[model samples]
Each structure stands twice: as structure tokens, then as C-alpha cells.
Target: MRFSTGLAAASVLMLASAAWAQEAAPVVASVSAPASEWRAVAAENLLVIDTDKGRVLVELAPEVAPGHVERIRLLAGRGFFDNLLWHRVIDHFMAQTGDPLGSGEGQSPYPDLKAEFTFRRDSQTPFTAVAAPAGSVVGFLRSLPVQSQPDALMAKMEGGRVSAWGLYCPGVAGMARDDAPDSANSQFFLMRQPYPSLEKRYTIWGRVVSGLDVVRALKFSPNPDGIVTGPDRMTRVRVASDLPEAERPAVQVLDTNSARFRALADAARQAKGADFSVCDIDLPVQVAGAPAA
Candidate 1:
């Protein structure tokens, strides 16, 4: 199903402010982190989508939405997403696809997935906080931005863990469903900009580590329904691990837990002042030895 129509106006306003902030903020010099501070993304968890626009690389977060990740992996491996049209797209919002029928109503023969809007996070979870406001802590878990209850509350919970959910930052990937919370099937969307209102209401499975510009360049529909007359299609989709070794792209992300990352986050917070948000920070990514887009 489509997102709540009420969000469209709010999204436009938010996008305007975000654009202004991006233009006004001083550019921070790229940090040179130690090699130890760089972590290579697992090939199996990296999704490569070659669209008519360009190549988009997404780093899947199974820890947050295992079921959805598995579904994506299975379908991509089976080439189910190949040539699937991006049927619905909204500027400064998101692009929706993954329907084999090229219409919003289709799905894989597999069953619909249950909602995974929240996950339990314990001390073992790799979380690096950028901001702690009152009762909630906002941070990054790998490449995905997240918000969760304070770590102190974990001890009070039954399983020594607290509930956490992914933030709908720009480039976030989320499964789309009908009004029913558990109706998510094959369709999903890639965020074009930040929209915090979707937090905890949708299951976030991954975040784009590279080529977000390509996502933003997708042709958007002028129709209020977001249905495109002629849409761009996914030429091919595959898990990095499934590709031949020589063809696979080597990807590395700046570790969020590293001191260099903390310094970068601090710089961003200071620059944005009260308007600061974890989404304002774009983690550094390095890609090497990949076939040309």
C-alpha cells in the first residue's frame, strides 16, 4: 500500500528545510580514519541494483529485519526483480518498486511477511549514540540510523534488552504494505529524503551505502497517485556474493563506533546546532574493484 497521503505536505515542508540546511551548512573536510576504523561490508549482505538510471548499492541490515532481508535476498537471487518497473515515485519522498507485475498489486508467490517494526537491542548490539534526548537514544547500528530506548532501561526489561527501530533517513529501504500491519509482500521503497514520522511504523531493512544520487535522479511521477506513465526499470538485481568474484564490488564503510566517526558526528552536531539530526551525517563509503555501472 501507499504511504499516508497526509505525509505528502509534511514531507514537502521538511524537504525544503533540509535542502536549506544542506546549502547553509559548512562543508566538513573528509576525515582520514585509520584502517582499523574501516569495516568491510559482507558480500552476502550487499545488494547491487542496476537500474536504467545507475547502479545503487545497499547494505542490508538483517539484525533489524531478518525476514524482509531474507525475502529480498531470495527474490534477487532468483532474478525476480530484474526488469521490474519503478511504478511509483515521488520527488523528495521515495521510489517504490519490486512488483513483478509492474503494478503495485503484485508480489512473489511466497507468503506475506509479518511486521518487524521493532527489534530487541541488548548490550551486545553494535550501537553508537550520536544523541540522547530524554528517554530515547538516537544512533547508528552499522550503516543504518536508529532510535531506541536508553541502554539503562535494558536491565529493567525481561530479556535484558530494549526495543529499537530504524529511522527513515534518506536512502533507507522499507517494505511497503497495506493498512494491515502484516501485509507487506514483495514491494518496497527507497527513501529520497528523511521523514521521521515513518519511524517505528514501517520495517526498515537496509540503507544505501553508495549511489544515493542515483536514487534521487529517478524520474518522479507528476500524478497525485504517484503512478508513472513510463517508468525506469531495474535492469538487474543481485546479492554481491552471488556475482562472480572478479565482478563483485569490494565495499567498506567507516565504522560508526570509531573515534573518527564520533569526531565527524560532533562536527555535524555543532554545525547544525538545534537543528541537528543523526540523518544529517552521511557516513563515508569506499568502493573498489567493481564492474562499471
Candidate 2:
């Protein structure tokens, strides 16, 4: 709706900051926005989430998690992760879901955000990175994959400069919260593996430029090892403003805000940190202006 509370969790340092994870919270998004309102940022440069299987492109870094990509593009253009499911398959690592109340604590009528840790890739991200190691809030976008920290610390306490929100992996999406950091609301996840304690806590924004094998074929529901049991139905979730605006799908997000993503993070930190394996890092995509595929 109209959304309240207002961005940055109403400041005052969101409760003087520090302290997080109340754990056990996913009821499937519907908190009802009020942590100070903000969520709504996708003028359209490519978002398309359409999942029944073949289409998972999510390149909305908006210069690094601009308020968690404008609150998941105003809640995935409103359909709010339609149907929501993909629960929590692990396999190679990653394939969570946006939990429209799969009960991961992800419910969000609104109001939750207040983490978005880092950003500083620049010129409004264009592409390239992959050196990986990051964790002050992450860095690296194509050489090995990972970003955020362009001007974080909440844009230096809401002063200016943005771009930086890469932390999770695999299909890397975000929202799901509870231990604090404003409590997320729309429970979300998608990182085949490599947590590193969820660098910058959690709120990753977007990734998976293409259909990571239908999110690695999703189908794991045991949880407890980490707490993500799902899949009842989700034969849906098609966003991109509900496609068909000539079949909306034009993409191009590799820019960690770009300078060739720090020269591919210096060729992925001088090559060979075991030669990459977070599914071989690949948030690279290209559908072009008129719906190419």
C-alpha cells in the first residue's frame, strides 16, 4: 500500500544498531512496511523472476542494494514472489526462496529492512568481478562473484553515494530476517554455499542473472541443519512487472558499479584461490533490449 515507518528504519540508528538474528521467523512475508518506508526501486533495467522453471534472471543491484533493490522492486512489482516456493534445496549450494510464508519468517505486508552493508563499485554499476574473499560487507562481482560496499554504513549514515549489496550466492536473493536488523519480513535465501557467516548479516538484494538450472532443481526440505524446509507449491513467482510488455526481459547487470569491477577484482585476487567454485561464479547475462532470451 502506501507504506509507512519510512526508510532506514526511522533512523536514530535503528535502535542504536548492533545485535541480530532472532532466528526462527519465516511465516512468508507480510510484516506491513513501516520501518520508515522506502521499498520501490525498479525503473526497469531488467528484473524478470518468472519461475515455473526457465527464467530466474535477477540483476537489480541498483548500485548495490539500494534499499535492498528498492525493497525487492516494490515487492516484486506487487505480486510479491507470487506463489513462492523453491523452499531450500542444497545440492551444490543455494536455491532458497522468497517465502511467501513458507514459514521461514519471510512474510512482508511491509516494514523490515535496515542492513544493506556495503557499496562502491561506481558509475552506477555496469559489470565485472570475481576475486572473492570479501566480508566487511563484501566485494568482487565477476572475477569470482560478490559485491556491495560502495558507500555502505547505510550510505555513510544516509549522506549519499550508493551501490553495494552482494553477499549470498547461487541465486542469491534476500529479505528474510528476524534476529533484528529490522526483521526482514519477506524471508529469502539462495546461496548454494559459502556463507562466511552471511557477510554483512543478510539482505543481499539480487543475483542469478539466468536460471541457475531452475535454481539447481530445488527439492530439499529437511532443514534443522540450518532451518529452511519448504515446497508446497510455488509453480509461480513471475515478475518483471508481469511480463508481456512485449514479453519484458531485457537485461545487462554485471556492473558491481564498475570500473570493470575493479579489473575483475584484480583477476580474482591474482588467480587461484583454488580456482573458483561457487558454481564457478557467473552472474553474467545478456538478453538485450527487445526480449532475446
Candidate 3:
């Protein structure tokens, strides 16, 4: 599903202004707690996409979109994404790639994936609530910001569990599907800004933990059809676990259960005020063994 919102575009400015008020150093220091306060990105789930523009590191979320994540892993392991162009990019919106043919209509020979837009949230899920107002709960399932319906609705659901899904915030990765919701295959897109209209329509499989600017810096299509004649291509894509030990990039994220994350979430809530959306906050990520900045 493809969606854009003028209101969300305006909301981006509000989030930007709030972010501008807080310096990176203090936040970094606060989030740099003990080793227990950080969760290392699993090697198998780490997606390393080296594009002509720069490298983009994505941490897959199997808990949220299992099928999509599995497909991404399959494609990357087979090198299906190598030399794939960012065929469609809209300024301040999103950067799309993963089509080997460099056209939006292309896909792998692999079978199409069914939509995994939302999943049943179980009690075992490690969701830390950041906001609970009335009937909804907004929280972090690790680094991903998610929203779930009220727990009271669980009994009405098929599995007696409430539904949850990741928000389409900046740096979030979503599968690009055709009009038929289940037509998604190899193509995907990364959000350059928050897009609420796309919240429940598209499946969010992973997130760009770092290098969001790299996504924003990609060459964009000038025409309305979102077709780029010659765009920066993803030269190579690999799962970190598949790489040799020396070539693997180690990454860690601030633990959501830690005081640091709570403090940051509170600060963001305070910063955005009346216009606060969960998208205003970004989970801090630390990278080593490679130049992330």
C-alpha cells in the first residue's frame, strides 16, 4: 500500500523542532547505561545494504512481520538485492528499492507473500508501554514503536489476543505491495518521515537503525510517476551472520526496559507536547566495526 499525508508532512516539522531542542550528546550519555541496558542486534537478523550512496543497516523484526522478515533474509542470502537501484524515491517521504528490474512492477521468482500488516500480541511479548491513554496502548517492542488495541478486545479476537503493528515512522522499512494487499514480494521501501496514513496498510518488517540521512540523501525522481532513470543502487546486501567474523558489523540498541529509554521517552513526550506522536522519538543505536556516521 502507498500513502502520503500533508498533515503528516506538517507533523514532521513539529517533530523536527522538538528534536532540535535536545542535543545528541546528553541523550547519548543517558542512554549509555550498563551493558545490560543494551540489546545487541542478532547477527542473523542484521541486514547490511551497501548502496552507491552509502550503507543502510536494518534490523529485522520477525515478531511483527515474520513472513516479510523471512523473505528479506532469503533474498539477501541469495544476493537478490545486489545492484538493485532505489527506483522510486519521494523527497521527505520514502526511498524504495529491492526490485532487481529497477521497476516497481518487478519481483523475484519466489512466490508472493501474504500481508502481515498486524499480528496478535501475546503476553510473552516484551512490550514496554510508553503511553496508555483510554483504549489504546503505545509502546516499544524492542526498538520498534508499536500501537495495539485495548487488551479488553483480546477476548473478541480469533486467538484471544489483541492486535499490534509497527508504526510507519522515519527509517521504518515496509514492504511495497500492489493494489492487491498480498502481492508483496521482493520490493520494499524505507520511510524518510512519519506517515500515519500508511500505519496499518503496509507491513513493517524492519527499521533503519542508523543512516537515515543516507536514505534522505538518495537521488529522487523528478517526475510524478516515481520513476528514476539512473539512481544509486544497492551494490550488495547481506545478512551479518552470513559474513565472516571480521566483516560483520556489530550493533547495539538502547534497552527499552532500562531507565535510559524511559527517560528518553518521557523527554520526548514533554518535548512534543500537544502534537506528540510516538514517531517523534527515535531509539538510539550504537555501531562498531564500521563507519556508521
For residues 1-293, could you state the per-residue lDDT of candidate 3 as single tens digits? 22223223433554444343232211222455788888999999899988878888999899999999999999999999998989888665678888877767578999989999998797778788888867899987877889998777877877777889898778899988776678789989997766666777788999898788889899986655556777888888998898888888899998888888888888977876765777777788888885421
Model 3 whole-model lDDT (C-alpha atoms):
0.79
Which candidate, 1 or 3, has the higher lDDT?
Answer: 1
Model 2 worst lDDT run, 10 consecutive residues: 20-29
For residues 146-227, could you state the per-residue lDDT of candidate 1 as single tens digits? 9999999987998899999999888999988777788788888898877777777778999999888989899888765677
TM-score-based ranking, best first? 1, 3, 2
Off by over 4 Å in 1: 1-28
TM-score of 2: 0.28
Top TM-score model: 1
Task: Tell me each candidate's RMSD, in Å, in order.
Answer: 2.5, 18.5, 4.6
Output the TM-score of candidate 1.
0.92
Compared with the true structure, all predictions reach lDDT values of 0.86, 0.49, 0.79
